[model samples]
Target: MVKEAGLGAMEKPNHKHVADSDLISPAKKAKKSEEAGCDTEDPKIPSGAEDEKQEISGGEEAIAAVGDRAAEEESSSCVSEEKKGFLIEAAAAEDRGGRQTMEDVWVVLPDASLDFPGKLRCAHFAIYDGHGGRLAAEYAKKHLHLNVLTAGLPRELMDVKVAKKAILEGGWKDGATAVCVWIVDQKVFVANIGDAKAVLARSSSASELGNHTEASCNPLKAIVLTREHKAIYPQERSRIQKSGGAVSSNGRLQGRLEVSRAFGDRQFKKFGVTATPDIHAFELTERENFMILGCDGLWEVFGTSDAVGFVQKLLKEGLSVSTISRRLVKEAAKERHCKDNCTAIVIVFKRE
Candidate 1:
């Protein structure tokens, strides 16, 4: 069973993009594309191709329409550390913020072994930030992971494309940015498309074993585990131009969408928007502390450094992962005054 152990608050959005008088408060928590094309038609990825793939190097052709390189089915780099037996814990949080509808959806499956049968022992976490409507977000939350499970749960990198392709199959005019993580024993796999981000906090030698004081917190490094995929990026812009797509003065694809890679943006697929995720994998060590998975709303006001420091401080104060996640969401929505729906998940790899 997927032990949603410390699940704080996760709600089912009405799945709309309109206002509601029943908008919930922060104290209570909960949860939750485009286009067509002319030149490059919609992607026709088969459902059972998870096995016949090679790990594509990052930044070469992560965009689906950019090349024919198939993504691998496992983490490219994973060193065994199962002997460490790190205690992993996770929690979730969300807020409507200034938005009428909550368009962010997330899931935490602490035991993904059932989904993969007799394969690797795995745990999964994901966040999807939706636009145009909450349908894409809701649909992706419910079905994307299932689709991935059906196709063998993706190696490490190619999972988001499966998610985006499944969401687009419904011919919906919505889109979503995805950030997902998988923990298989001591190995960590981070995958993302669009702007939703995953940040890992690594403690220094002193911070890992020292007292949870300000001095111990100062040495923590916030390592961003995923790349932002927006049209403004040089490589992304070049691909969009080559695909016969145009970026406006404001850096949006065809003067509409900002992210050059996402799910369910069929209209922008030919415009160089892709579903391929940049997957990163590594083995966890003692220096690793925790991870934060959040949408752009939280990121808009919370820098990676700011967030890591904030969480570390709260942890020193003896806050649980569940409370820390809720506080993080409130910090982004209330204190930071983010005008968009905010959601976050904090996963602690080894809690001392």
Candidate 2:
């Protein structure tokens, strides 16, 4: 099990845009697409086809040989340390809807040398899911890290309890969900506002399971690092109600915003909606392998354990990080059939 800590907050400028509540009707359910299956065939060949088949096979082999050589050269040139102290792989994939731009923005800063007093090297990763428009998501992607870094380092922003106070004080507009992960040495810090999520996939320890066997294979466990802030959550709904924000019959914030927390949405700020994030800090163990940060579009269709299992299966097949991430986004888009944009980032921690 993953241990969780307190929360934090950040602010962003606001913008005017239609919240997701406007796009989706509460009464309607999205249709799930059927899984496609592959078809295979073995056709009979004539006696004279042997020579022709050999000629075609030789040509195909030659082409494949050239392609392999090119791939090898390209891979070598592209390999580099993403950050000064860590060897990491990161990738993002997005699928947009017809009317709107992909309202998903992600960031991967492998090495952010802060101006802190000590030898502090922080690697930051985040995903922002924009609701009304791309402005909030884009803005958060660019500024959220800076704000967190400023609060965490030079200013010593260590008090997590003050997150709510900061959000109430900050002025922000349009709304967007945010999930962030900051790595300093072996410690990992995570924060989230709204439904965007962060999950860690690692090997389960024998003690955690309370059982052990020498021949048993250790199972992989999915650790949800962030809590989703939506009206559906009891606490969130109560907070909204107390703040004069009504949870509509359709389960929206004042029948406008679907999420209960976000970076912008100045309109909902007074109604109890907040930009405060649930923050957690923990040390990364050798058993930990990778972490995933994704927008709700992915989570809507794939559960935490399901997503982790899918990625782990792909990793065991020797798939690269980028390929795994892109596949996940595509899978979510196809499965969810949701009108919302989809985005995901996969970060693999290499053994030093």
Model number with the top lDDT: 1
For candidate 2, the TM-score is 0.68
Each model's TM-score?
A: 0.71, 0.68
Q: What digit string (tens of lDDT, one per residue) describes model 2 on residues 72-111?
A: 0001001113433346666666654222344556666666
Of candidate 1, the 10-residue stretch with the lowest lDDT total is 66-75
Cα RMSD for candidates in order: 12.0, 19.3
Which lDDT tens digits does candidate 1 get at residues 1-352? 1122221233344222112433211111112123322112222212221111212123211221100001111001112112245667788877767765566667787776554564445677877776654445555565555554554544344343443333233221234677777775566767677777888776656346324454344646777777787888897899899999998787777877777886655666677767666666656777677888998888888988788888888888887787788788888887888887777888876634
Output the worst ten-in-a-row residue range by lDDT, candidate 2. Answer: 59-68
- Report how far residue 132 has shifted in candidate 2, in Å: 1.0
- Name the regions of candidate 2 deviating beyond 4 angstroms: 1-86, 97-100, 114-118, 152-174, 205-218, 335-338
